[model samples]
Target: MQLISLCSGSLAALGAVLFAYGNGLSKWGGLAVLLLGTAVLLLSLSLQRRQEKEVTRLHRQIMDFLAGKNKTPKFSVNDDLFAVLENSVVELESRLLLERENTRKSSKRNADFITDVSHQLKTPLAALKLYCEMDQARNLGAHSQKQLALIERMEHLIYSLLRLEKLRADVYELQFAKHDLSRLLEQVWEELKVLYPEKKFTIIGTAELRCDAYWLHEAVKNVIKNACEHTTAAGHIQVLLETSETVVTLSIEDDGGGIAETELPKLFQRFYRTAQTKASGGAGIGLAITKTIVEKHHGTIAAENTAHGLRIVMCFPILDGVLAAG
Candidate 1:
């Protein structure tokens, strides 16, 4: 455009000179300058249009590639003006492909490591468990009992880690079914009673929801176990279930020494143990596994300190056509 303007201005100057001189050469000289300037202007406009089209084409190619229409972009620069841009796009594509390959390899390595460790520890854990059972049969003394307890704790830790690893790697399948949420709670409560044999558990309400019965059972058991461990023998733990049009919520509240305010956010993180829980022989993986299971079922789990204790709530969204509780 600037070149075109400059040429037009030069033509005007030549015309002015022609009028001033009025020589015989003025007429032909002015006409020649005007024609040359017009040609330059037209050529410049044509080049600008072609440049615009090239840019539009390049942008479309990028969009197409991003939208997954093309795995490999077919781009060629016929003009020198776009040579730098074309090179940059090609370089960026190469780097992105390399990064994706690296990520895939890293993920595979992680999964392999978890699988190998789980397999390698199983035989030894089984043998230890068998030894503990035999020692219990023999009516072992206090030291033997302590050793058995330690062995049991170690086995629990190993199994919990394996479950967490499988969950992280998406290796386990969830069997979703229409299960009675109330019944599941009752079963878990019964199991907890048998496990603790000293704590009290209360059922407040009942509601039915669709979920993976076994996995959800595990999740709720973890929460109940947590409550039992945190509460005193006289303290009460309550299970409450509520259902709405779009969601089903199950809450476990206990009148125990509640968690510290700062620990609420970190409660669901794997291997995160508060100072108070360290002596409780908890590996800190139960809540993490529970969170992962809840999330896999398209639910959210959170913890809050109540006026007297702690409450853990898990809510799952109800899809269309699912049964609603009255």
Candidate 2:
């Protein structure tokens, strides 16, 4: 617009100068040209102002529509370009909303199905366990004992699946509070000692943070238990706590040989097991549940190979006043 105005003004000035001083040009003709140039300049300025106003209004409408202040945008019928853009945006928004609704419904249905099936299986599983106990009382052979152990393993797997599903579906309620981190790890270690009596476990350092004690306990226990399983009978598992100004890190390192680099990334995937874990009777659900729990607390978990073995690091952000007071 400015360029057009400058060009028109320059033409008008040239014509006026010719009318005043040029001998070859007719005075009347130069005057007529000057008038025409001035008229063109004025007309271009008017059109430029109108176009700018229209563009401003269009920009505001598009912003409002995107911000959810307007469901439908209005535009002048003569604005072919802007009108086309508005229509395209509306169509894209509709498709996105529809897809979002479908995803929500599908997730709800899947969660409900899992919950129903898990509940239904519980009754039959309980009966099977009862029958196995009765057979044991009758002094069943080694075969019957193996069958009972399999049933117990199945029960454990079913419960782990239910927990993982609930976490994924965002249905699990976490109770967060400031708790002593050392005490929590000690509590978990106490219960695990009976199961891995030969494996040595140790907790070092102390700190406090806001977290869901029960779920965090489960998460820490799973990591330590996993470490115990992968290590030798006399292997040492260390739990170390370190806190900085903004982050709290809990690291669990085991003397067991670290997993392959390729398999580390998939360690937390549900039902994903490497040959070593599969041989240990791992259902591969524990670490998955632990990952979900840590995420729920707005934390992160990662596994890396250490010189001695594998290290699982869980880091949590220290919100204002949460760790400072502790």
The top-ranked prediction according to TM-score is: 2
Candidate 2, clashing residue pairs?
none
Per-residue C-alpha lDDT of model 1 across residues 1-326, encoded as one tens digit per residue: 66775776676677656656666677667666667766666777787787788789777766554434546644555558586786677677667667756865675577678668878887887787788778778876546667777877877887788777776555676666678988898898877787678777887777877777888999999999999888887778998888888889999999897989999999999899977679787889999999988887768999999998999999998852221110
Lowest lDDT block of 10, candidate 2: 317-326
The per-prediction CA RMSD against the true structure, in angstroms, equals 12.7, 10.5
lDDT of 2 at 316: 95
List candidate 1 segments past 4 Å from native.
1-109, 123-145, 320-326
**What would the TM-score be for candidate 1 when compared with the true structure?**
0.61
Candidate 2 CA-lDDT value: 0.83
| CA-RMSD of model 1 | 12.7
Clashes in model 1: which pairs? none
Error of model 1, residue 170, in angstroms: 2.4
Global lDDT of model 1 = 0.78
Local lDDT at 271 for model 2: 95
Give the alpha carbon lDDT tens digit for every residue of 56-92 in model 2.
8766765564444655444345556656765666676
